[model samples]
Target chain A: MKPGPFTYHDPTELADAVALIGAHENARALAGGQSLVPMMNFRYAMPDHLIDLNGVSGLSFIDCGERIRLGAMTRQRDVEFSSDLQHAVPILREALLNVGHRQTRNRGTIGGSICNLDPSAEMPAIMLLHDAELTAQSTRGVRKIPMNKFALGFMTTSLEPDELLTEISFARWGKGHGYGFHEYARRHGDFAICSAGVLIEADSRGEVARIAIVVGGLGATPVRLSAFEAAAKGHRLADELIAEAAAAASRMDALSDAHFSADYRRHLAGVLTRRAMKSAFERIGVAAYV
Target chain B: MSVNGRTYERDVEPRMLLVDFLRQDLDLTGTHAGCEHGVCGACTVLVNGRSLRSCLMFAVQANGASVETIEGLANADGSLSILQECFHDHHGLQCGFCTPGMLMTLTEHLRENATPDEQELRVVLTGNLCRCTGYQAIVEAGLDAARRMRAKKEAAE
Candidate 1:
């Protein structure tokens, strides 16, 4: 398949790219072209102008400090192999290993995945786990949007037409915190039928001080198990407690498709969540009962 | 872009895929195009030393970048590279439609990872689909190639 005809603009500056998108009525920003180009070839997206962001400067970087900041154009492969990210957020690398294959990851970008907002994508769910704040830029100005409020619906984001996602920043979990991510897909590189991401911080007394659980591929957007997180805090991660959280995850709303039923997805959600929680507990020196 | 050690200059349409540019414009037909929507890795090539699906990228996207295709995998004197020879010894292909893509993918994999286990090779190969040979022979070839390359590097050292 071939993409439909359209004028292409490769702006070398961030402001120029933002101006182009803001000026054009139907212009789409081209990040790594991992997802956008495929959609264009399928005729699902036929933007009249393509604002290529590859040439833009200062948009492909990784800054690690109190909070980790990643440029929108930071390639997924880079993120997967970044030593800083692995040390700060090991679960990101673990989850990225399941995001498509090596070839796709070489060109895919963090911003592209978040903007695409595939319900089964690992990046969005991981972002949700970290409570990331995204920076969006436009001709008007820049604004920060919390990850919880970014996704509007299925494959749709709250991003305005003219806004360009610039950077994503999230506070890093403490050194002793443990994180785990799990995804189940039909094929090795396919999007997950259900995915789970867990981050847990244990207090000096070996009890859960803070926990964030995110279940993806079950609904229009990744759902945070806030109720479970609140209920389970200050408690040890026993097998029964993990099972209860998984049960709550399975009862959440899910979308059914031709290949998978909602009930099947829900079942997978429960199984994956349990496994993820167990792994997280084990990482933090807690012995989860079989 | 510099492709296969040669720099080429041409004006292409914005919609023209890199695979089409290589085949139709430069006549580098060894890089086959399959499932142009990026699912099948038959159009995979090295751009800036990283393996990427050529079909997913526009021709202009390769501006000033270096690309390597199947045509460049052979020795400069026209003999097959050690990896291709390993494929030949292990019978890594049947119909040979996916050979180019598989070879290119494994080429990059072996370059970065001097020694990869069977499971790692199999996982890396998931990007390229091979309907024939059941992937067993391909995996064997990859392992064999890795061994040979390691030996060669040791000898050189």
Candidate 2:
């Protein structure tokens, strides 16, 4: 047995779910339960009422329009296998594959993953790099939140109790695109001690137009190093320049954990940034942050 | 809520984890709880088609949900699927503790990707932890099954 006794309610409609959350201040919206379930088991989270959102159907589609709109309830496995996502945001699809193991990914939702907001998570870095916008709903109505502001701290997000994440949107990346999502964990499928995600865009001349390098799992939230991005503003991809940029990027934030000390994480940050940027450059030669 | 297609709608303590609920309350001992935390996947189950760690989930969490344990992997006749047959052929299991969870996950995987590569197979079975066989036999079993499965498809076509 765990901690608090809670009432369970599965609302079929979005509005009903929002209303239930609004009414119960301590209620939680359960998406995949990959994180929430374990927390409850450990008595880490004591939600009075559990608002299970599995009944909210059709909320797990990856729609490609002006922006890639991924329903908040979409599972990590769903995103990993999405052909539409593979064609559009290949980086995200690749990143989705990096989330935990296949079994966890099968039941872990993209929204739920971000909502849990583990610092070393790959999805949040992907979202931050793409400048993804999150749609949060409540009894008061809906609000569009940016990636930077969405993730607050370790296992912390800006999402209010009354608000449920409805969708995550980012400008689509077309074909002929290159991408890479890289992270270093103690073992495969374990939480990354340090991770890096890179996204780059080219101009009409095919020169580098945009560069977004995001590092997560090493901070309270995904942190984008502006100094490093500035280094890549207009120059072509070069090794020395990339190394300098990665060093500058690593200087921004160094996370500390028992397994990996702050200095080690800093070293990992720079190394991963270099590798991620190289692979990404090799791929768009390809791909951000919070 | 029911497990392995068996229904039990009695009142239970909120603190009881779904894994314990299945093993102790329901008496379906196939659902083994390894590493009470989420690290080990030995306690994995299909909670509404998605494999999740039962140790991490509370019994109340599955109130409106459907969960499939190792006991539900086979048909009513209790015959093993081809996936299981491949495991046996490849000597995939050693201690046989992680076999139930591994088989459940691999079965679902083959259903989706009949032809999975080595890398794909590795990532797919990442959740289930095994201390025996060094995973070569299990991964070999999955790959071997994929080849046979593809050949069967080609023959049918």
Candidate 3:
């Protein structure tokens, strides 16, 4: 399986890369080449030009400030290993470890993962959980899109052909924030069958102060359960409340494929949601009814 | 590209994957192309001292990068490397199709974590699949290699 012939452009500058993608018709930006290359080999994608972003500078970095600014080209392995990121947003690390294998992570970039936008990919779910923002650049200018809006559908994004995903940023959660991420896959490195990402913050009275719950591999994109969040808001951590949240998740219109039935995915979604909520509450020292 | 400490220069197609460039053009066939889609990890190679699936990368992408294939894993004196020796002593391989990738993956893992325990080694080897031995001997070999590597490092220090 060989990728079809294409003209390759390795631009060292961000502007040049943007220009290359803009000027070349049917051009695809090659970041980690993890997803695109495999698709190209299968002839699922055949771009006439490849704008290689590997040589682009300033697109692979992590800066901690009021908000965490992650360059699009930052490798997944770097995110897993970054002490700063682990301290700032521990759930990012938790989710990254579940992505692909160590070798793939070494070469796979964070931006590439988000741009790939696999419904089962952990990065999109994590971003959705954090309300992350993505910066897309083109010759015209730069525009920021929320992670929820950035991902349109399976393997589809709002990014135009000429635009490049340059950076992703999310507000840093304050101290006392507890995060839990869990995914079930057939194999260790395989894509998730059903996964859950949870963020929990409890008040002094052990009541829910802030929380975000997003489930992946259940739909075309990671689905956020706002109804569950609203229902659990201001409620004490209790078995009934957790059960209600899980029930709400089960009602989502989860996707059904040959490997998993819609009814089963609905069941697992509830189970995983309950598990993630329990783990998140436990991390905050609030005993959640398992 | 300087592969295994040897330099070679040639014009190649932009879409030519690194695995094809190595096996077909350079005659370095040790890096097998099992899945050719980055799942099997049989085409794993060291690009600039990091393990990468050569099948997922273009030759032009690695133009200035130094590469290391299975052919480079042996000692300069032509003896088996410590990791390779451990694999042999522990029967880590049977069909030997995935051995090159397993060695390349472990080489990078050992370089990072010189004293990885059995559990950690198993996690590291999850990317490289081995069907023949059910991975018992491979896990043992990885732990043995880490022990030997750490001991040698301690002696040098």
Candidate 4:
């Protein structure tokens, strides 16, 4: 099945796009058309109007200065292979590669992924781990929203009808930090049934500075395990610490879908957490090679 | 609109998918639609030199875009392109549904890299799925095509 009849408009300016969507409450903004088009075909969603953001170029850049700024329309493929992201935020690069296959990554935009707000998305988990900020634009003006507050519920977000995600910005991964994402899915290009992203910062002498363990594919939005991170702080990636964090994650209300039960998700959460930490440890070892 | 170096103009519904517009409307059925939901790569096509899921795009959206489908790869003499020949020689296709998309994707890479390693070939052919042949033959075919294309180009130079 294909989408129902609709009018298509390619707006050049961001402001113009906002105006178009604001004028028609039922209109849908087409970012990458990855999630939207699929639903439209099966009649899951039927918007009468579609406003394309492709004409408004220059949204595919990743700027690095005091902070890392990623344009909303940046394709996942670009992020996956970007030397800038590889150097500045290796976790994000890792997350992007594990998104979909190469073709989907080439067409899937970051804004689309965040706006879709899939609970199992890898990049969102990384965002939660780093406390990233999302910038949204509307005719009213631009406003920044914390990643935690951006997603409200399953496939739901705080985005207003008139607003569109314009950019995502975050502090570059702190120096002397090991970042990693680990997840498991039924297939190589499929969404994760359980996923976790970790950020472990170390001091000059290799003493622990701070750490964050955020898990996705577990709730309506990505959740950070501050308690687990705090428990592991000042400690190394020993088996005991990994087990403690794993136990902590196992106690959270992990999501249960048709693919996985809550109990199984909880179990995988602990396993994935341990694996993510192990990956981080290896990443720390190979930092000098890269 | 100009497609594959030829001009084609036709009326289509604004909501009509590009793959449908090609296969049903324009009668270019070489572009297959496998999942229709964009999960399957059967509806792959080149839009302005970039590979895209035609199932996810509206025909109207491709108004001024340059499109190249599997049918467009043949020459005036109706001979198969080097990539197509390699697919036959290497036993790459089975079930035949995924062949066109695979060929289109493989050709694009061959045209660019001319010759690619096995790993590179596998990466470029990732989205196009084949239920049969175990993908080993497909990668071999892609490599075979790329090597021959590179030789032809070098010989011409």
The candidate that achieves the highest TM-score relative to the unseen native structure: 1
Indicate whether candidate 2 or candidate 4 has the larger lDDT.
4
How displaced is residue A202 in candidate 3, in Å? 1.0
Error of 2 at A123 (Å): 1.5
Candidate 1 regions off by >4 Å?
A: none
Per-residue C-alpha lDDT of model 3 across residues A1-290, encoded as one tens digit per residue: 38888888889999999999999899999999899999999999999999999999999999988999999999998999999899989989888888989889999999999999998899989999989999999999999999989989988999998999999999988786878888889998899998888888888887888889999989899999987887687998777767887888889998789899988888888998888888887788778756
B65: Cα error in model 4, Å: 1.5
List CA RMSD, all candidates.
1.0, 3.5, 1.2, 2.6
- Compute the lDDT for candidate 1: 0.93
For model 2 the TM-score comes to 0.89
3 or 4, greater by DockQ: 3
Each model's DockQ score? 0.82, 0.59, 0.80, 0.65
Runs of candidate 2 with Cα error greater than 4 angstroms are A174-177, A204-206, A285-290, B1-17, B47-50, B56-67, B73-80, B145-157
Model 2, span A10-126: residue lDDT tens = 788888888999999688888888788777767788898889887787678889888889999988887887887788887787677667787777777889888888888888888
Q: State the lDDT of candidate 4 residue by residue for B32-66, as single tens digits.
A: 99999877788888887778788988887788889
How much of the real interface does each model capture, measured as fnat? 0.89, 0.72, 0.81, 0.62
Can you write out model 4's per-residue Cα lDDT over A164-199, one digit (the tens) per residue? 888998887676577778888887667888898888
TM-score of every model? 0.99, 0.89, 0.98, 0.94
Ranking by lDDT: 1, 3, 4, 2
